[model samples]
Target chain A: MADTVLEVRDLSLEYRSRRGPVKALRNVSFDLYKGETLALIGESGCGKSTMGFALIRLTPGTAKITNGNVTFVDGPNRINLMEMSENEIRRFRWTDMAMMLQAALNAYNPLIRIQDHFIDTAKAHGLNNKSEIIARARRLLTGVQLDADRVLPAYPHELSGGMRQRVLLALGLLMQPKIIILDEPTTALDILTQRSIIELLRKLKDEFNFTMIFISHDLSLAAELADRVATMYAGQIVELTDVFSAFEKPRHPYTFGLTRAVPTLHGAVEKLESIPGSPPDLVFMPSGCKFHPRCPFATDKCKEVEPKLTAYGGHQVACHNWQQVLEESQKAR
Target chain B: MALLELKHITKQFRQGKKVVTAVDDVNLAIQDKEIICLVGESGCGKTTTGKMAAGLLDQTSGQILFEGKDISKLSGPEFMAYRRSVQMVHQDPFSSLNPVRTIYQTISAPLLYHKFAKDERDARRRSIEILEMVDLTPAEEILDKFPHQLSGGQRQRVSVARALTVNPKFIVADEAVSMVDVSIRASLLNMLRRLNQELGVSFLFITHDLALAKYFAWEGRVGVMYTGRMVELSRSPSLIEKPLHPYTAALMSAIPEADPRLTRSKERIVLRSDDIPSLTKLPPGCHFHPRCPVWLEGKCDKVQPILTEMGPGHQVACHVAFDITGGGSKISAGTR
Candidate 1:
């Protein structure tokens, strides 16, 4: 069996706004194996990005990890990121883990040259040689299929959206980190550029053998790139399984609903059956199960008692009536 | 009959000392009740073309003919009638709708402006009907609620309802579902599809995603653009199955298959050094020859290819594409 690179146990996070306390993530637990791609997928505001932030201990403004242990496994040493000092975390970041955000097009400093972004990153990580940094930047830029000379001196606005995204990718690889957190890295890009970026990312992961955490609101996209998939709803992981199983034999009602809702590129055109209601507001979350309000198979029991994610035949699902949901869907079919 | 036809239309904009041709010479025709999807990247002028076709913007040169009559000089009742015949659905549901305006007011504004209703009560009743048409049910509940209170999907439905309130024969949906979430996107797309089927409304659906364009307009035609020029036009299946232009092939190759196994085993064309050409300084000859994978040495660099028909209702603009597929000797661009 492959070793676990990172383990998030009973992870709970919340943000205190003027409105109230909003639970961004609730008891989220998962294991990221070495050299594996883990996809966290859900609707917008489903806390997938929140989980990414919490894992790296960079939960944004006013957000606090109320409960949980995010342990980063390094060889034999287990580092609990939550307990690490600010200085320690800062040192650990980029060198140990790097993040390519959703709006990566705007990630670069618009006024500065692309080479300056690379050099600044390298110098921060203690690479003092200017020639070495320039050479390294050239190599990385070439790896992402960009002309090093043409792009290095150009400002962010000078490069195309695809080229700018490539610069961000090269920046993410500056330190050769063990883990890469890609939060919708290709969301705004065109399909051609998006495909090439994904291909390049997958190729880089294979070449470097680094773990990847892909956070997207697209399930089909998640299925295309990830080995394992975690379906998040509201703030909890409703289902977690391998990509094949998650797509082929989803146990949770939300997963089933999602599989039917997305339009497909291949196979017959299936009418998209949208889940009736919208995702619940985080501030005024539903009583028991957060997804209960929108779930078609929701019952009185589901409305009162929250279901914990439990393992069944190597897959984890948080649903009170998976069996009934299956039977009812089967009967309807 | 063709409801609208764009004959050799061109749009240019001035930027400092540079004059950028946002849309080059193009031709397209939208038949009554037919959905024609315009697929391209950001700078490819798909949105601008849609805006021109909707009468929201005017073309700099050439002619825009609606029902075989020029629309450029439309005045008085003709311009007012044209406005009612065409409508637009913008991309962002968040900013498109007025946050302070209730669904009723937002939908009824156009009807009230054009005097489509007898009075306020009559206007609201028709707005409710349009709301129900786009699947916003219990219309009374949504009618009074402000835009902020509704979900993204609901807001998009409201926008569609507003467009429908004018009883427009055509709609220019500019990236309409791109801002909405994936699960909600389908419902909106289906609603658009339903409108096309049931209401017989022509659509100039503009978007960057070809898969979505194909999904919504399966039976209709798709036009592929590159650097403000329509490179290929064909029925949806043919375009997806046997795309002729190199750019179309690149775009098609970029689509992520839903199946992981298929994607893993699939061979994708990752272009080498794709620097999107500037609108003001497009390269000589083919606009895409710079990044094309199978570009001809001297021919593709010097000769600008025109949109040439290769099969029934299918057209492509590339010199060596046919030769690569051994279709070079079979047929010429003019034979169709």
Candidate 2:
């Protein structure tokens, strides 16, 4: 088997607020195989985005990595990202793994032209030949179906939201990184623009053979893009499986609630069954399982005992009554 | 009587010496207890039309009729009454509700203003009742809590309850669920559907998300707008099943399917590299001609097409629709 492109083990992140340290993520573990797209899907405050930011060591000032390790496999060499020095991490950022942030319009410098941004990055890495760097940037733009001449001279503000996102995706691929982290890349664009951007990402992934960590609040989009899916609740990953299995046969109650909550074209016009309550407050999370407050299948044991993620049918789920829930979900289907 | 009618409405704002036509010669009829989804991309005049329907802005020409009465000339008290009957739920739940006010005050203030409730006690009771109607349990606790203490879903519920408190017949929900998480969006949509089924409230649901609109609207008519013109209006399922306009086809193709197994096969309709033409200086004819993928040789650029009935209840405004309909004759925009 090919080596894993990225491996995250026992990763926990905490945000130090005025009240106390809020455990944003707990024991989150996953692996992205080479050239595979892994989607981290969940509602807001589920720590999906937090996990993405943590992987890149770009957590906010309030957040701190409490425990865990992230290992990046570079060809035959294994690099421990968490232990890397600051300068080394900077050097590895674009060349090894790049990130396309959620807000593309804000990512670029407003005062500079698009081409200048690429020129600066290429020059910083000591690629001083201007014509060669320009050619590379143009090629990247063409790969994303953007007009090189028009986009290279326009300032970030001059471009539309869709065009700006395409430019950012082009920039992320410029270094020819092994993995690209897309954090809700199409969230800001309209439907038409979003479709184009997703198509571009799919095409680029096929051409460059890069692994992807796709994070989003929309499960349907994630289903369309990712090979495997992981569903997060509160601070932990409650379910992880292949995309088809995760959607067709979700084992966890939280996953079931989330999937049913999305309005689909194929589904009947039934009253959407929403989870009764909201997510637990991170500062004062419920005892035992953090999801017990909202889980309809919660029992006395669920309120008192935490469930570990256990393997079942080539998937991992963290629920005491996952089997019963799966059976019930199948009956409903 | 039609609940509301906008006939030949047009709006222009003067920026320096130039006039920006935001809404141009638009006509629409909204039926009672019906949900009309006005969908388009950003800056497509959907929100502006919604604002006009809610009496937030005045049309530069033509008339706005409410229940067969010309409300275009109504002012002061009459306009206030019109406004009370048509409440608006804004897009951003985070900033829409005041930070300091409790949910009770946010919802009850409208009740108090309209004198719908007898006193504070009655208003508070009604506030809690409205919260329950939106499926928000433990209404008393939520009533006393401020907006910041609630999540996006909770805040939106508060907004809906506030809109419902006035007993408005028509509600303009402009991208109401766009800001919330997807998990909560369905619940909110269900709540809206319930309200429509039970209260017989007419809705002008404006959103860029087409899937949500399809779920909530029955007999829903979709309006595809480009620039300041309505390109097409047709039944929901018919439009999605077989889109007539190129723009509609593109929009339908944009929706990401729920099943990952089915790959999207439609070729993406790539628009021109030029920016959306300025409203102040619209291209001479067919504002969409510059970006349209299948622009005809000279008809699309030289002459504009007026909205013509292609079939029963299906209207399209494009020169090519006739050619597709097996007619060679072209309709001029000026004739309309």
Candidate 3:
């Protein structure tokens, strides 16, 4: 909690669509401490991934950061990521900050051997000697529980889905950046493979003391890995707290619904109570609260006035009716 | 109560000259209005088994009896009618539902093809009622919209409605809600449960997720598949609470617990460091022996173990589980 590595304040992003501009991230703010994992969780089109892209100034297609302040505090020099020059930005990537992309298997070049990817990334970041790069890649691959002797010579297509993912993870750690961002790293993999990868990451994070921002739509996976969690709903963080607080006593109604929606490994076969109604149409968003239509506890005021994030007892929630929600939840428990 | 019986069902596909055994000799029976979940990872043959049951694909060497009659021996028109009763709901609804056709057309096609409705008006009414069953309403408004216009959840509901057009007696839903959003996934799962209870429709639900397979499903049995074989089968609650097979135990232990403190600190059953095996060229004898924790020496590697009864309505296919050599340390005390 003392050593803050990345501080994001009032980050807003937008994407240009056929209809008009779609607000993706709205006033998203959080602080990631050293060696901590902050999970950013939300449903599809909820700006979870967009926030990841915005942090490194790589917002996809037609999307632009309208306003934000992402301050990197741990490095020798304190710098705002957005205000940095293009030349400075290139050096910051993979040197100061690196990202393990979602569905990273498809991002690999099919034609090239897997070793070339590490060699090229090292060369780009000023690790010039081929032997030095190869040796490091071998060590990192071993760390990720992959055989470098077999994987380095194989093409991306030749490797299985799990192997490809491990290689991508190894590449993410090649530079040993201060902060590593993982976006849906375990998705689409088998449960066993996903478990191993999660374990491996946790082990590596403890040893290296690198700050990680894990982004996923899967709240369960996020809960397994993250120290703190920020639940995003329709372009805004609805609740931000430690994992236990978020799961046991969700301040926001949306967060509560999400927590109960998932079917855990061991529990009574309780009927999953789905949140009715889909996410609001971004282009023609409804009045006041974005989640009002789906919120079970929505009042007239909720529809008329948007509530700002307020801190109460260590948790931050953007709900006008957190008191009643907490009381009712506690009573149920 | 048993409605459909699979007797020694084995399905193989020809890839050039080599034959790939997709589904091995397996026997399963689905009761009327019963929900049976086939849970496994990719290449585990759950999907292949589901496809074979739905008549979308055929078995290479076995018989599938629908309502006490061999399905393959049915007459052409009778088989066509059988196809209507055994419907399939695929994972990707967008691809399953014709993109060019409206929601109404897509649903009514099955009804019309089976001659369930006398005229176009009758087909439309039946299709609309089916849509209403799936909770796609104002059903009349979305009737004219194409698959492209509908959201992933809505389209999935439409596919379910299409399957129910002929009032099918059984449904084979292969990862039906796996591709949809989590917010809407529970609703689809509820719909399937509703259909089972209200309309007396049996389901062979196929999914890679063991947890998802048990959603709204406590009364049914779960079959755990591994490398073209059903490794374990047990009552849903019992399977999860006390998994006997090494593969099932490993798979269950790998699940990320909902709570954070337990997730971080729980003693998990981590398997040995080995890649998921190739389905065609599987490991000898016991398919999971190479990665299993309770692996035996010569017995496990030399001879494949058959499904042995470990308890009432529970079966496991692992040599170490049953103590083939009658070792006192084996798991006889834990068997129910």
Give the winner by TM-score: 3
* Candidate closer to the true structure by TM-score (higher is better), 1 or 2: 1
Q: What ranges in model 1 sit over 4 Å off?
A: A324-333, B270-273, B321-336
- Tens-place lDDT per residue, model 1, B79-123, is 788888999999999999998888888888888998889899999
Ranking by TM-score: 3, 1, 2
lDDT of 1 by residue, A1-333 (tens): 499989989999999998898988988888889988989989999999998888888877899999989899999999999899998998788999988888865688877899999888888888989999999899989988889999999998887777888888888888899999989877888777787788788778777778999999877578789999999998999999999878777788888887777665555556778787788889998888788888877899989999999999879999998887666555533
Worst 10 residues of 3 chain B by lDDT: B327-336
DockQ of candidate 1?
Answer: 0.66
Clash totals, every prediction: 0, 0, 0
Instruction: Please give fnat for model 2.
Output: 0.69
Residue pairs clashing in model 2 are none
Q: What is the alpha-carbon lDDT of model 3 when measured against the actual structure?
A: 0.85
Per residue, candidate 2 scores C-alpha lDDT tens digits across B43-94 of 8899999999887888898898987778867777876777788889999999
**Candidate 3 regions with alpha-carbon error over 4 angstroms:** B324-336
Cα lDDT tens digits for candidate 2, A73-97: 8778889889999888877888888
If you assessed candidate 2 against the hidden native complex, which CAPRI class would it receive?
medium
**Higher-scoring candidate on DockQ, 1 or 2:** 1
What TM-score, computed on C-alpha atoms, does each candidate reach?
0.94, 0.94, 0.96
TM-score of chain B of 3: 0.93
